[model samples]
Target: MLPLVHNELYVEFNDEKQGPFYPAEGPIPFGKFRKHKKSSVELKADRIGELAKTISLPRSALSGINGSDQALLAQANIVQMEKPKSMPFDDSPFLQSTTFKNKLDAKTAIADYLGKPLSRLTDLQIVAINMILDETLDKKTVMDKIRAYFTLSSAGHSGGD
Candidate 1:
């Protein structure tokens, strides 16, 4: 489960009511936004998927409730009218963890493996590292793929290395 903030955006669509309605992006509506910051209010992925199935609204409308471009991206693949299968939500523990030491260790390990300064890496880089690690790729192969993916320069490194 994850806490979500529903900040309405000002946009007009023929299917929706006129004036300050929620949009996926752009300006905040009515100079205020709705927030669900409490852990109890958070919705699990499966629960969200189920709730989405019951709604007549399109996926785009649900994305608008998320109130961020990243949230929109996360929901892009979900079918608005279909129910999603139950799956473990990885983010729950990560978000609720009392200590960040494990997270920091993982990040540092990724930076070390990439042979680059951690400051230069983006959030996407961290995600890629986690993906590769979870898939249990061999060290050299994973590093090579990551280097090529990021176009990082190295000795004997070809453009697609």
Candidate 2:
């Protein structure tokens, strides 16, 4: 979701397994966006996919809770509903990770695989580019080849776990 905002103009529908899309180009990697500072929370590896569920028990679900417990629950509700403050863009791993290179090498390779030129891509066609890159980086595999097989296969198909 971090990279999604930067390339929003061109790749509004990135499929994550690939990268953003340009209407003229198709799925490509994180290209050189005019503005490119992306911000995201860095959760520990141990907490990667853990969903924030069952963190607090509902008043109805707990029969023995007293008035103080109910007050605490109300306070918790307020905190949970408040919009979360975002961290600084420089805090993102993309700035330091080897997988998050800013150069167009990966983007060019992805464009070649998709049979499209980078500049020709419009503000549409690409979908979920960040997700694709994130998943690819996690797997330690080749980015272009991975994108090639998926783009050559079918529309709406994803290689993500």
Error of 1 at 138 (Å): 1.4
Candidate 1 clashing pairs, residues 3+ apart or interchain: none
- Residue-level lDDT for 156 in candidate 2: 59
Candidate 2 achieves a global lDDT of 0.53
Count clashing residue pairs per candidate: 0, 14
Per-residue lDDT tens digits for candidate 2, residues 85-106, read 9976776666555553543555
Per-candidate TM-score against the hidden true structure: 0.24, 0.23
Predicted structure with the largest lDDT when compared to the true one: 1
TM-score of structure candidate 2: 0.23
Look at candidate 1 and tell me the lDDT of residue 96.
Answer: 55
Residue 31 of candidate 1: its Cα lDDT? Answer: 69
Model 2 regions more than 4 Å off: 1-100, 118-125, 136-145, 148-161
Which is the leading candidate under TM-score? 1
The Cα RMSD in angstroms, rounded to one decimal, for candidate 1 relative to the true structure is: 27.3
